[model samples]
Target: MVKSADGVIVSGVKDVDDFFEHERTFLLEYHNRVKDASAKSDRMTRSHKSAADDYNRIGSSLYALGTQDSTDICKFFLKVSELFDKTRKIEARVSADEDLKLSDLLKYYLRESQAAKVRLGCEELMMGILVCILKQCRAVWLGSQRLVDWGRRNEDLLYRRSRSLVDYENANKALDKARAKNKDVLQAETSQQLCCQKFEKISESAKQELIDFKTRRVAAFRKNLVELAELELKHAKTGFLCVAPAILELTQ
Candidate 1:
């Protein structure tokens, strides 16, 4: 564990630890699922090329978001197609993720996608939703920073607090003063305990926020499901209608 100057314990992580181990798992899993879905579409002899391209774009955006690299984010999300492909399955699963226990925010987001009411074209919904979510998160992050600052200030107060130990030449006087000093010491100890408890509560609150985020994400996903379903349905109908032409051409 790494302790900050003020004794805040920051846990140790592994080398590949992008501080997103939990998130990475979810991303990789989702990526795999999307790839699987695309592969299935390929089996249907749909426009695999377009889907594959969208898949790459989604990966690129995921990489950028994970690294906080706008360039990568731009590559993935700049195109409407890429955005939709990436976001589609995710929103579909958002409700599930919210209800699950997660060690990382990314994982939480990933799990939420599972609870999606409509299992449909996740690709189309990825961009618009994320663009909005990111903007909202920026505002919330700013607010959190202020709260963190307040916590730090409260800790700072502890560092400057002084203890006074007075000694009287007379034994009786010394005993009396010691009793009073002991009370002061007890007060300090109580304050420290209170701070510890407050810190713990704050940590728990952060955890709850993550859970709540996953939950709220489901609502957004519900709104997006219709479009996803339409896309999937369109793809299915298009493929069905096109099969006869391809079969006839192949028979030649």
Candidate 2:
């Protein structure tokens, strides 16, 4: 994908140049921006945009609090950004692959994303992220092995390489380097190396409270769907349909 008319991809970075390193410039720029953005709580989010955005902000805030040193916070945030970016790219690649169901990819990314946040969030968020990630990791590990086998069986055209594949490669290289320095150093668990604490399963009370609020929100959810259905059905009905004002509130 990085070939120009002269069979050369133009380098985006100006400072230094490496011909063989196609992804180096883009990766460096991405890392630098995320590193800077993640460090400042001021720029985290003045206004929460979406659920993912909210988690990202909270993750950054937690990074600031959980560590004693500035270097620790910066490193943790960079690790999470790497995970998040890789997860996004993997989701896109899996979606575009004709051999894979997009649902599986989305589910994998969702769990990975949440897991990254958990390694970086609070008690409740961490527990949720851990549980989901544990399950997803097992499935993904198996799936990737099978995918490789399938690729060999099918002439290697089924699925594109996942973005996490690159992250995994980088992580393995780091592990190898560390191992070379000190043979006694055990490589940490791939999933929980950065996870500070083991999150216990959440309490029933918290689950119930969240569920009750969501159940109430569904009353509003149905109103929008029902309104559209009614509009279609009542095109022939001339009389005024009397709907209660309390129900009208749900429409909005």
Candidate 3:
């Protein structure tokens, strides 16, 4: 056993083995979580693309509608001019120049006023529709952007988790190698019992060195695990505090 920086005794074999097993379990769970997060990220990316496509389509439609409205307005204005010219011709034929009849003037004014009102109403209705569509497009754009940001944050977390797993695996392999060496030393010492008494002191010193080395290894591995845990916690906090708020802002 070896003492850790925190003054806690760390076992060389049993405790280390148990710790590694726990880490393996955690790594498995973490890997699954990463996979899930990746799938979600992919979905979010696809959604963003779809939203962008929709925005483009809607923008094109709005442009076409605006152009059509302008063309229709121009046509209506020309038709109104034609009506006025016809009215003048009729007035000339009816009275040659006697101050245009009050009835004729009233008729012309009423027709012009009605046509203007209809054109204004149509334009207003179209504008309202365009405004509604634009608002919807803005909301969709915001949602897609939020998803992309969230997904990127998740991917960063996943990368950290993966690195931690790799560290754990490397630590486990080192421990395994140390254990094998210790086993070889034990077997050789046992087989050389003919001179055991003469070499008793040396054997004891060797045993102590082996124990110290194993203890140090265990303590170092435990420290690594602790650091990994802290890093994971930091990532979790960042996601909640930073990414979550950004997502909320987008929603708003």
Candidate 4:
């Protein structure tokens, strides 16, 4: 039985077990992909910042040379240095925006996905003895025990009934005991039917829960990706606008 968040026990069905297995696989693949993405995003942010610093250093060197020389060429160098300074500012902004929108987003989701894996009760994901232990594993164990108990009781009842039948055939004096054994078998049958019904009900509920989980994660990923794209476009446009006038000035 799987323990729900509310502490209620739910039966484990084939579909629910399959769902957990599928989800576990998905999370593993997704975690690896996102880890790589987050690392790349970090590298990109650093590259942007490094480029900005280089631009600033070059602009400063040019400005110093222009000031020391004081010629027409120096004036031209001064103008170019000013353009470099402007470019440096734009690059800096780009770096900040990329870190905020892309790097941070990737990192947040990386952590979130890890948390999700834990919450899903993955067998391979354990923290301590009591912390984030595998709920699915527990469910499977309980389900197995339940099945074993039912089978044992069924076999015992059948064996008892068979023996009672043999005794009834062998002697007329064992009729009352045979009737008692038959009654016990009938009670066991009733219990087996109730157990089956309860199992079916829990299985249906668990299946729906698994379906909803899949849908919810998909929607969340879609929303985050859309937002990231929009922010990236905005940053690109702003960077372009910042550099256009500098390009025109240099051309003139």
Among all candidates shown, the one with the greatest TM-score: 4
lDDT of 4: 0.58
Q: lDDT for each of the candidates?
A: 0.37, 0.34, 0.37, 0.58
The model with the greatest lDDT is 4
Clashes of 2: 0
Model 1 spans with C-alpha error above 4 angstroms: 1-8, 12-47, 50-184, 220-226, 243-252
Cα TM-score per model: 0.31, 0.18, 0.26, 0.55
Q: List where candidate 3 sits over 4 angstroms from the true fold.
A: 1-16, 69-187, 190-252
Judge candidate 1 against the unseen true structure and give its global Cα lDDT, from 0 to 1: 0.37
Across 1-252, the per-residue lDDT of candidate 3 in tens digits comes to: 111211121112122234334533543554455445445544543554454455445545544444565576554444444333333333333221111222222222233223222221121111110011122246544543443343333323322232333334445555566567765555444434423332344334433533443354356336534654565465456445644554464455
Error of 4 at 38 (Å): 1.0
lDDT of 4 by residue, 1-252 (tens): 122221111111122355556765787888889999999989998998999999999999999988988788898788889888887887787777677556655665575456544444322222211121122256634543443343333323322322333333333323345456765555555555555455455545544644654565466457656766786687678777867877797678
Name the weakest run of 10 consecutive residues (lDDT summed) in model 2: 154-163
Give me the displacement of residue 133 in model 1, in angstroms.
Answer: 11
Q: Candidate 3: TM-score?
A: 0.26
Error of 1 at 12 (Å): 6.4
Local distance difference test, candidate 3? 0.37
